[model samples]
Target chain A: MREPRFHEVEGRSLAYWGLAALLAAIVAAGLTAAYFMEHIGHIITGMTNQIVWGVPHVVAVFLIVSASGVLNVASIASVFGKAPYKLLARLSALLAIALLIGGLSILVLDLGHPDRLIVAMTHYNFTSIFAWNIFLYLGFIAVSAAYLLVMMERRLNSYSRPVGMVAFLWRLVLTTGTGSIFGFLVSREAYDEAILAPLFVAMSFSFGLAIFIIVLMAAYRWTQRPLGGAILERLRNLLGVFAAGVLYFLLVYHVTKLYEAKHRGFEYFILGTGGIYTLLFWIGAIFLGGMVPIFLFYLARYRHSRAAIGAGALAIILGGLALIYDTIIGAQAYPLTIFPGMQVSSSFYDGVVNAYTPSLPECALGLGGVALTLLIVVSAVRLFRILPENLADIAFDLDPHEIGATPNRGALWAPADGR
Target chain B: MTRRKAKRELDAGRRRFLGMAAIASFALAPGVRLIGSAQSSSPASARANSKVRWGLLIDTNKCSETCQACVSACASYNGWKNEGRPTDPQWIRKVAIRDSETGLARTLPVLCQHCAEPACVEVCPTGASFRRADGIVLVDRHICIGCRYCMMACPFKARSFVHQNLTDQRPQAPRGIGTVEGCTMCVPRIDAGKVPACVEACAREGRGAMTFGDLNDRNSAIRRNIAAYSTTRFRADLDLDPSVQYQGL
Candidate 1:
């Protein structure tokens, strides 16, 4: 087999420039929104004292989780010693770092006092989970950069395994830290579950793989590179399994909450009475995010079809956002259980559902984070040799399924089993 | 070697002098002198000590639904008056509770519980939300980044995020937009040897329902009230060890 050479994308194309301009415009709009919010106050936005964290948190969390998840490709190749994924490892590391930076930008920009960010870095409250997250997030970025450097340098190739293991462990801790942000909040019924840490880890897996597939396909297709069906099959299978893992964790979270008589109100609110949250969980999270993708992975034909797999990945992304919304905003909407049995009423919206309507500015801010992440990924691929020349003849490195299976040949979704 | 040893000796002497100076000033200050006699009947002005946990005892049986002096007083004092907005900050508010089984209606003012193991202080990223030496939970606005994680962590919904900019902030409270604020138990008044404005207002309205004193002092009115009645801590199951105790739920 001839060794594959790396090539940078020709960024001079009109299509490329247009896409870049569009993403840049979105980012600019987001920055403007953040500025106005800071200049005037949070009163301009839909977020209230009641629903403290809104669209920005949901979007930021999604990006942060996906960033850690994006590194799975590199981890597979370097730590797990899967040869086929080695070609995609550099791009994975790049995306992981870029995505985290983008996520952090949105989070910091949306702060009550963005200027006081200096205080956040300077002050250390060891007991606070948020404080620990600062270290975990920054460490992940540094480790991922080192891993990428090792992958790029031929002389440093031997160090890739140890560094990759470190990066992998760092990502797990990062995602766990993110989940524990909610889990440590013993005050709220929706949070305070020990399972939340591992649940977030699983969520990172599913959301990250879904995004990786989407990016991989886009990069391969736009650059007119040969992305083989065999690689897609492997990634899609992993995505499906992680997607199933997400559902299992969700089940455990809800069941645990339901079993506790004290937490029953929270369960009822999210599952039954909570209007938008309930719909999002049922249709968006469970059905589209989990079921459809799992179905796609199970059917041999859909699994091999890039278009089908891409669609499933897109659904999972949307579903993941819905799940975050359900967790952050929905939980806040339900008033704290101050008085257990007595019917309590107050001027502070006590025992009442705090209404929230996401305005244009908040929505723009969220979209800006997404656009910023994609902008980095797109720009990186263009400036550097991040994409492989071809994966057409790459053999399956870690599985026996490749032995008897024939490759699918079609434009879109087609039967690959020679039926 | 001789020069280094002499310098080290001088440094140690300077350190000893500074520590002694600090202790001497503290002992001589009026606040520390007053704190020594804090167990007295008359109002005591003092720097708070770990041994003195200031708290309030509310006799709900004497609390009347027709009277809202405490609520209005808190609003005016904290400068958190309702601006007719859905997101208006409420530091302390009158909570009307009705028992479903007995139809027994009771009205009580709810504020920060000032828990020993405050969840807000625990979850705060910057440790801006903190418990003082006297067990008074406070948000140090200087360092608070207003992430509102403390607001989420608070079980009583006692904290409020300053959603909008303000021009006329109370000089005593010192609040601003984009930072979380809550009932401070009138820390300034407490320091000045005066009961909280709400407690005074309640008394002026001919309802001495609220009692404020040092909980650690066995002879204190607040301590005696708690011992004499079946007092309840809000959400006792959480075991936050709230300084504020309530009677007649």
Candidate 2:
């Protein structure tokens, strides 16, 4: 690849300018809202005593799930020794780190005592799922960053491969832990399904692969880089398989809930009055997130087209968001029946029937999280030149007798010292 | 015959004198050292043996939703601000419950059940929440770290977090922002040998909706009521063995 060199570029691109403006507006609105919340308490938001956690929580979960998804590219390429995926591995790592920070930001804003968040780490509640999630998320972020650093430093390419694997495994466990936060609440009854954890795992992979393909296409378009056709095709096929798996799991999860009949009220809400959530799950998540992506990848021409890849990526992201929204909202839609044979009339104002709409401030904060993620990713990309601009010309084979041998092995691996 | 009558009268007089002397000694026992010692020891022993187990029995069927007397009494006694945004200082609240099958509803007053085996007590890392020997559960807000795990662990949703900054909080209750709180069964009242605010309020209304007494006392009205009428505990399957029992509804 002619020994990658750095050169100062001219004025910022139009895309960067647009992103900056959007970010500024979002941050300003979020700050104003946060100030109001701090001064007046959570009453400024739609969240009431019954609905303690509202839209910010949903948005936070969505970002976290997507972040976990972003980890799959590195897991597939570096840890699993998938050669075709290696070209996009660095970009995926950056996205994973970025999205996690975004998720964390949204979560902090949602807390009643944002200042007391450190208590989550300081005060350990072994039995509380929320406490466990706090630790798991922190661990995931740490391991992911370490692995990314190892990759960036071009250090211990061999030993760090296992480190990447460890990171990947940890993130999968973390994602499952997040899912179990809702799933393990047996008292809630609405979220007692055992399949939610595995379902989240499937989502992580599907969303991760979808994001990888889209980023790869964008990187190629912007930098005039050309990733190998063989690699792209392999990724598209894997994504199709993952999308199918996610769809299957989602279907089984719902069917099992219906069959149990105990949580029928929750099922009714998801399949009935939870119209928007139901549509998002069925149409956005299943068809757009799963079927459409799979179909696009199946067609030879569509798989290679930038537009098709972009559309598939957009669908997967939106679908992932919808799934998270469904999990959180669906769990709370039904009231906890303390008395058997007692029916409570659902009201729009209080208790189980409490409705929530994200205020402008909450939406702005969510947008700010997205902006922050992009800012981080773009800065990292600018500083380190993480993404390989010429994937085909970069020699993967290192041995003298190999057809694509390169003499750069010492340069890449020397700094690691096998530590 | 005259001699026999005189002898009988003499015997009766001697018996009456001995009985009067015994009565005088008993009345002056506190002044006599030996008798005083005996009386003091006996009363002290009785005091040492006595223990009070405070509890409440609520008749949900007879409870009137219209009467806020209990809430008012509790607030006034505890010096809780009853106006504005109802704060977490509410020790007792009337929760309106609806029938899941019939959609028929009734207002039921819910307070801390004061479970014998409280999950909140078990989960408090700082030991801020504990069940007393008298069977009342209380949160020592002074040491509370404001962790909401107790809230989640509680089956009855009995705990509430204080959310606003505070000044001049009542010394007896002493609640502040960032502390979990629940009904105390009016521990202050119990110590004074008076009925809890809710029980007194219910009694005053002549509905007999709430009865408070020493659960350990078999003769207590609460104990008799619970035995006479069928009662239910919220989420009894959890096996918390709650101290509070509800009747009729």
Candidate 3:
């Protein structure tokens, strides 16, 4: 593989401006919602002393988890020495950074004291996982940016391998830290399991790849560049494997919870008794999020179809979001059993499930995070040479579908334009 | 009491200073001398220390189901009532518990246990939730980011996030928007050598069901009652070493 040439997308079109404007509007609404929540306090939202974290957490965690997952393509190329993925590394790194910034913005904006971010940064409680995550997330951004630089600059090419290795390790730890935020909560029955860390890693892999495929395909299609069948096939296959891996982890987590009689109530509540949670866990997270995507990828006819692959990716993304909702809101809805074998009732709503219906402000704030992610990605791509030119014709040894087909080497190479 | 003993100790040390003739004349003439002196100062002015671990013992047998003296006292003391809003902060509350099989019902006032190993303290991102040297767990609103991680980590569900802006906060217990609040075990009163407001209210109601004292003192009434009766900590299996104990579950 020769030096991969990068190109800047022509971002001055009506469609481009319109999309950017729309996303910016959504972001503005989200900011406005955050302002109201902060000004008036959390009384406007569904979150309470019982269900402390709400939709914002779901949105933020999904974005943060997916951010770490988005870098797997770069890791595969730079760390595992996959030639095909090497060309796509820059875009992956860029997406990771954009998604992280967007996710973190929602998280910070939703804070009770968004103004007190300085206080959070200045005061370091070394023992808290939340404090540790602040450093991990910031460190990931810095390291991944360096990784992108190493990939983009020919002069720094020698450092790319080591830097990529560091980024891969850091991302693993970052996702683990994210998972442990809930995992280490000893007071909650649904958490305190060791599986949550690994479960998040698996979730990141699936969610990240699904998002990467969608972005790659969209960028290629909108720019009139051929995405080719080869890379898509490999990505589709990897996505299927990751979806399966997520299912395996889910099974292990549920089984582990079920094995302990003490945790049985929680499992039953989420699996059977819990109303909306049960539906989401079964239909949204399990069936559509995991199984449907896996099936779409495995079917020979649809596996190579760009539309089917995109659909699969979209399903996974939606599923990932639902999974987060199920985990976060669902877990909180089930009342904490503070007292054993006693029917407890109090003014504080003890022993009764807490109700949370997402308000418009919460929806705005959460969706604002999504729009912010897209805005960053679109703006960044327009400003930088992140997207590879003519990805369709890159000849590689592992193109299973094109083993005997002649490589369109001369036809594929295009000069960098619109710099 | 303890203040009298401390004053006596200060006077004994002051006697050595009285050995000097000039100082002796001034010290001996109590009615005419030594204004604003430290020897007669109350022990409550002294800083809280580890030598005493303040605790509460609640006897359910003596507690009446209809009474909410402790809860009302705590709310008034903390100033957390927000027009009876569903999200209003309740530092202390009465929980009505009934056995599922036996159908035996009882009422108990629950608040922050001030655990030796508090889950809220451990999970606090900014160390805002902290246990004092004397084992009073409190949230320093100055540093609290209002992430509410402590609310999730508290086993007793004792913590409340201030959902709205607060006004006219009591000088003793200052609260605001977006900070976690909980039962402070009446630290300000405890520091002033007075029992917690809830305990005082309960006793004033002629129940005398609640006792607040230093757990480390062997002769403390709480320790004596624990020795004489079987008192149980809520969720004792967690090994939190709760300072609050209850009799008659």
Candidate 4:
């Protein structure tokens, strides 16, 4: 093996600076809102006895599903043995770790007492899906972080194949567990279906792939490099496949609910009620989120353009958000009972029955979570030097001998790289 | 094939038949006795027996919306202060239920069902909640670990947990923070040979919505009323064989 010269890249571009500024603004707003929620208590939020969980939960689940997408690069390299994804592994792993932390932070802040979160871990109810989710989420964060470490460490790099495999398998189980939290409620009548778990898995792939593509494109731009035409085409093809899978799962999920008619009230809330939420599901999720992205990716010339790929990625991310929001909101939209010949009105919210509006504080905490995610990603990139200057160089690194020539091998261990 | 072998085989078959006979007798004995006793008992003895187990029959139709007298009386008798919140200590709660298809609403007052086979008792790890010999489910707060598992196990949602600290809680029902509680059918009143506070309150209100009597007493007011009018238990799918019955929904 020959020694390779160190290439000192210049500071971040204007685009990076702009993104950082926006992220900081979001974080500041979110933190200020969170401080009020904490000091004033949940009374400040729109949440009441009826609608206990609102936009905060919606945003949390959105980030969680998006975080699931971080596993795609590792999954392709370890599970499917795709060589082109090898160089992007560490970067994807770091993003996955950061996203989970962001998701958890939002969830913890949403709780009645941020201090009592340890109780959620210590007080285990084996039967309650919510209790089980606490454990599963912790496991996901640990495994993703461990895999990231293994990817970045020179000594542990050889163990990447096994570590990556475990990380991939764990995410699939974790996402399924997330789905089961809703699906296993046979008594709820609203969520008594087997398809939710599998649907969640499909969603994890779609959202995961979308985030990966966007981040990879940005990383390429930051390094003043370009991804190979063939590699970009391949990624676009995979995104198309994922979009189709998500669409199929979503269609079957809703159709089955309609067929059962057990949860007709909730079903009607999503489809029959013509409102912002309905528009979000039909237009944002089904069309732009699902169909348009697939169509763009399938077209060769469109898929090759970086801007077009970014647009498709954005559409998918927005669609994933819409899908999760629909799931959480749709379930609680109707009153719990619809017994024949019973006229019961809600006592909580006056006049407009079954209402929900996320308070300003809730919105603030959600934006804060996004800011935290970007900060983690930016800081990790600065310390780890995971981005490739060019796609051709990335292809070269895929070979075992060429990896030895990469510079600053010792810098991978520095504490500043902490995600 | 041999004489000894034949003897052993005969004994084994005899034991097997005996075991089967025992199971068959066990299954048939309750139904047979129920019918047999129905024929044998005289009307007068069935009406006035003190040894018979007391139960309540509530006519939900006659229950007025303003008739929270039962809840009030139960709370007062038990010495439970009304904080007027759902999370507070509530011995009895009135759940407003509406029919999904017809959209008709009715308020059903619910307390501990005092089940023959109580799920809360079964799932209680500390044995804090237990069913008495007479079939009343009672919680020993002294032994309660405050796990709240019983609250989750209850299908009717009858149990409430004390979430706040209070020094002024009444002595009769001096519940501390982190204890699960529900209606006790006014055991203290029952010990004094009086009807439960709720039953007395209902009777005083003149609607006669509640009738308390010994269920084992075949000719008691509750048994007779149940025989004359149709009654139902909430969530009968649980098959808990609840002592409390409701009529005229």
On TM-score, the candidate that comes out on top is 1
For candidate 3, write residues A348-393 as lDDT tens digits. 8889988888888988999999999999899988988899776764
i-RMS for every candidate = 0.9, 4.9, 1.1, 6.9
Candidate 3 lDDT tens digits, B69-150 = 9998988898888355556788898888899999988888999999999988988888888888888898888899888888
DockQ of 4: 0.07
Question: lDDT tens digits, residues A1-419, model 4?
Answer: 12222222344778777777888889888878776766555657765433445677778777776677777877787668876676667677777877888887887776544555555555454545555667677888888888877766669878888888888888887788778766754423346578998998888888877888887766655655545444554666788888899999988988888886555656776776837668888988898789889877766556345456678888998888888877766555545442223554322221133566777889889878978887888767766656655554335343322322222122221123221
Q: What local lDDT does model 2 show for residue A63?
A: 70
* Residue A317, model 1, lDDT: 96
Candidate 3 runs further than 4 Å off: A395-419, B1-46, B82-84
Q: What are the lDDT scores of the predictions, listed in order?
A: 0.86, 0.68, 0.86, 0.69
Docking class of 2: incorrect
Quote model 3's TM-score.
Answer: 0.90
TM-score for model 2? 0.76
- Per-candidate DockQ vs. reference: 0.59, 0.09, 0.51, 0.07
Tens digits of per-residue lDDT, candidate 1, A280-324, equal 899989999899899877786664566888999999999999999
Model 3 RMSD to the real structure?
A: 11.5
Better of 1 and 2 by TM-score: 1
Superior by DockQ: candidate 2 or candidate 3 = 3
True contacts kept of each: 0.82, 0.12, 0.74, 0.10
Give the per-residue lDDT digits (tens) of candidate 2, residues B1-249: 999999999999999999999999898875797767777775312332236667788887887767766777777666665343323345566667776666667766777899888877766645667778778888876556554546546666566666556666666666655567788877766766677877787778647788887788999888888889899998787678889999877
